[model samples]
Target: MTALTLAAAQTLSIAGDVPANIQRHLTFMRAAAEQGVQLLVFPELSLTGYEPALAAELAIAPEDAVLSPLREMARELRLTAVVGMPVRLAPEVGVLIGALVLGADGSLAVYTKQHLHPGEEAAFIAGQGGEALEWGDDRIALAVCADFSHSSHPRNAAESGANIYAACVLISEGGYAADTALLQAYAAEHRMIVLMANHGGPTGGWTCAGQSAIWDTNGLIAAASGIGEALVIAHREGGRWTGRQVEI
Candidate 1:
């Protein structure tokens, strides 16, 4: 693949507040575009603040008109973007916490969390398969929270020929250390670039860690954020990857 620039947005989300959060996403998208970031990923349930109680009422379809602006932005900036939201799975079935991928060429797809956390099954349904995105020669596999905790997730991506695995999650401070180790191991064992996007503030009564990060193929942290609004950028050039962070 051609050289790639990646970013993970660590931003705040208001519970069950789609309009307000959409504005925040737009703001981040604009800044990322200015920074020439080709791929931008946001934290899980970012559009509605990880509020499972509100998922049923706020769940949107894959082609929901509410996401048109994001699609337009991706196309206009020639940047691929991922927005986390609750998506409708079936008429009476539960919603799925999904990563809504908007591609620069106006392509769209949704990848849902296949592994539900301990308490998530009540609010969301598990998905069957992951989604892949191809840009130049980069093969990217998309995932939501919890999915990265399972070995099968990264293994499936690797078997699918993915060079990068990106996950968006709302990881709390107490669980950060253990979770990060899992991600690092996945990166090393799978021999694929690993990226994570986490929330910057409180959501659903839980305060997130906000340490969005990028792990290189060597199982080392290339870039990581602190406990606030931040962006972790990882660039691949000349077959080498370098990562840095921007905090606000």
Candidate 2:
């Protein structure tokens, strides 16, 4: 089998500014591509700074043209990128926290958050999560912030043959320790490589604990970043894994 390279894109978002965030995302994508990354995951609500209060107004369809630039860039770089945004399936369906996957082939897939954090119900509704991404011999499951908190979520992913669990989150300083412990446990228990993409700075009134990281199946840290914009990468080859951190 060929080598697989994955990365977590930790970034700081400008509240309610999709254009600016898109530019930053492009920068991250370019950097990841330069490093030969195959799959890149961004932090939760990365395009809009986790601004629930403005989600209703900011919600867009999965096929919205606003994301064309990102899709084009992903295709050009031949790198799959999972980006966070507010999604509205229809006028009647409530807004959802979505992880939209822009495939290297120029295809798009949507994964909504199946679970909501406390107080999130005021602006978003739970959704049926999307299918796992199939890449050659690997299956990758997607999670958004609170979704990974539910033990059933990761368990089901593993049960379904997913080998990698990628979570996009806006974790604050207060919740960092407990959250990371849970992720590491999930990695060890499920024997699935775990990747976490966290905000690089403050967002939605929370002081984000950056330190985005990746762990091997044994729950050992492969790579991790500090409190800033960076790309935490994990590369697998010859049945072994190695990692590195790149500040951007």
Candidate 3:
């Protein structure tokens, strides 16, 4: 395999605080860029936090004022980033769970989470969606939290020639271990690399698990973060991989 350095960032986003959240996430992106990482993945709903009720109240359009700093961060850092937030399709309309992709060149792509969990069905509209994207030499795929639980999500991406499945998850404290193991098994079975960034700290009415993780195609675990803000980096080459915990 060709050598590739991948990075995952665990971020803590306070509800309705867009600026602070962006700054926190950018801190990790800048650090990853300094370390020469090819890609940086952040937690789901890192931009606006995971408060669906608040999202309904403060939702911003895809072209809202909230994304200016993030766009600049991606270009300045020269690293691709995937960050999640709620997108208000229109002022009078409903919001959707969206993963916004920022390229090193300042281009953008949006992937809305199509699979909604039980109560979520009442809050957001499901995306008119499909599979993830193929970015440059990396065949990349994406999903929010619940989307990954379904076999079809990963299976479709792998079938479509995606080599890496990047997931932005908002994991509760209790479900961390089991979810991670299941995701690992999914990646190994599909023969694709898996990268997941999860929200941490107490936000809204819930506390999220902070075990951001990365697993290679060979069923080998690459890197994982503890319960806090962290940067995890890994490199793969010739079917062999190695990773270590490093400060950002």
Candidate 4:
């Protein structure tokens, strides 16, 4: 079986400061690369700090120079990065909260959130992307914050033949309890490894709970972070998953 080393990063993003956030991402990337992580995932809107009010203003195209460093890092470190950002749509279509995926071989792709939370509908436009990204023998699906709240999210991922369902979310400290329970159920029900990346600081008035985690297919927590900038690295080998954590 093919083995993959992945990292779920819990970080602090500067609200409305895309450059600063990207800088933090690079810091995390270098650390992950040192540990030979194959894939590193960040929290939702990590480039813009999940500020809906400023999403449109901060939205950027996939080719924007602001992400050039990440692309370079991906290629240099031979690591894939699933980074969250606000993607600017063409012409007048508005913007969507999205994930910009950078491949180890200089590939770039965008996956926007298919579902929006109630309050988000007014500020960010929903998008159409819920496909899995293939890495060797693994098919990994991506989810934004609210996508997990919808039943069809994980269902669609499993239907797509994904073995890993990863989410980039901004769960408030008080909301982590419920969200964690739901993710665990998804892992057990779908029989796929579950990975989550959460912010370590406040965003848009909510105190993000930085418990980034990985769960085995059986719904057992394999690795979990604490309430700060941290990294959870999980290795999948021979159909079993085990993990370790590093606080940064």
Candidate 5:
């Protein structure tokens, strides 16, 4: 069987600037492709920062033309990328925190945040989460910022046959410890590999803790990044896991 490479894109998003953030995401995708990464995940609200106040004004449809560049890049590089955005399914429907999957084969899929953070309800609404991504023999599940806060989320994913759990988040320094502990515990309890993508800089007035990381099935750290723009990668080959950090 071929090896699988997964990466977390720890990047800084420009506040309410979709164009600039798209460019930044493309850069990260290129870097990840060079490393032979098959799947790359970005932080929550990566396209527009974590600005809840501006989410409504900045929200767009999943099929917006603005994402053409990123989608094309993913198809060209043969890499599947999960990017965060605020999505509006309709004019009357409230905006949702969305994770768009740009498939290497040029397919598009959307996963909305099933749970909202305390204050996020004012700007965004809970959505029905999407299905797991099937890649080769792997079943990968996705989670948003606050979804993993509930133990039931990961539990359900594992019970549904997911071997990999990826979460896109915007964790601040203050909540880093508890949040990571919970993720680590989930990894151990579920016996699933866990990947967390976090912001590399401050966003939405919160000081971000940019230590994006990946844990093995045993909950041991496979790879982790420090406080800056970087890529945390985990490689699984011949049933063994190895990792590295790349500055972007």
Candidate 6:
């Protein structure tokens, strides 16, 4: 069996700043690559921050100018990256919160969030497509923030044979500890590894809980940032679990 090295990045996102946000993500990407991680996951709406109102104004087409550089970087760095962006759709229903996948060769695969948060309903549409990605022995599924709260989303992912579910979340401080416990239970019940990247600092008057974590299939909190900006890495070797932290 092949052991996978995965990095869950916790950082701050600037509201409505696509260029700077991409740069911030890339900085972490390079660091992860240098550390020899095969996969790097970032937070939801990381490129535009968590301002639902401002996301409407900042959302761009899938082929936007700013994202090209990220695509190029993913290819150059030979890393599989999951990034967040607001993607413009046809017929003016406006944008959707999309998890953009840039493969090692610059190919693109997008997964939109099916479950929308209260505020997001006004700014974006729920995605109608159900999709997952294949990487080595891992069946990867993508979820954004609130999507994981509903059992239906993870159920679909698990039913689709996903060995690992990656979530890009912008979790606020209020109910974070409770949410973490919830995620752990989900991971254990489903027998799948759950990796999440959450934002740090204050954005749009909301303070995010930066406790990025990776839960093993048995639901043990194998690796965690605990609090603040850090990289949480998890891997299993010879049926043994290991986790590490690296300050970014």
The prediction achieving the highest lDDT against the true structure is 2
Q: How accurate locally, in lDDT, is each candidate?
A: 0.87, 0.94, 0.79, 0.87, 0.93, 0.81
Q: Write the per-residue lDDT of candidate 2 for residues 183-224, one digit (tens) a residue.
A: 999999999999999999999999999999898767655555
User: For model 5, what is the error of residue 41's alpha carbon versus the real structure, in angstroms, after optimal superposition?
Assistant: 0.1
Better of 2 and 3 by TM-score: 2
Error of 2 at 185 (Å): 0.6
Q: In angstroms, what RMSD does candidate 6 have relative to the true structure?
A: 1.7
When 2 and 3 are scored with lDDT, the better candidate is 2
Q: Count the backbone clashes (under 3 Å) in each candidate.
A: 1, 0, 0, 0, 0, 0
- Judge candidate 2 against the unseen true structure and give its global Cα lDDT, from 0 to 1: 0.94
Candidate 4, residues 110-219: lDDT per residue as tens digits? 88998898888878888998458988778999998898899798998999899888899999989999999999989989988889999988988999888899887666
Query: Residue-wise lDDT of candidate 1 within 1-248, one digit each (tens)?
Result: 47789999999998898999888898888888887799999999999998999999999998999998888988999988999999986677779988999889999888888889998888888887556897778789987888888889899999989989999998999999999999988888889999999999889989788878899867555555477787888888898888888764
TM-score of 6: 0.93
RMSD of 4: 1.2
Candidate 3 wrongly placed segments (more than 4 Å): none
Error of 2 at 77 (Å): 0.6
lDDT of 3 by residue, 110-184 (tens): 888878888987778887543466565678888888888888988988888888888888888888878888889
Candidate 4 weakest lDDT stretch, 10 residues: 217-226
* TM of each candidate vs. truth: 0.96, 0.98, 0.92, 0.96, 0.98, 0.93
Candidate 4 positional error at 128, Å: 0.4
How far residue 48's Cα lies from its native spot in candidate 2, in Å, is 0.5
Candidate order by TM-score, decreasing, is 2, 5, 4, 1, 6, 3
Better of 1 and 4 by TM-score: 4
User: Could you tell me how far off, in angstroms, the CA of residue 146 lies in candidate 5 after the best superposition?
Assistant: 0.5
Which lDDT value does model 4 have at 200?
89
lDDT by residue (tens digit), candidate 5, 1-248 = 45999999999999999999999999999999999999999999999999999999999899999899999999999999999999998889999999999999999999999999888899999989999999888899999989999999999999999999999999999999999999998888999899999999999999999999998756656545468899999999998888889999
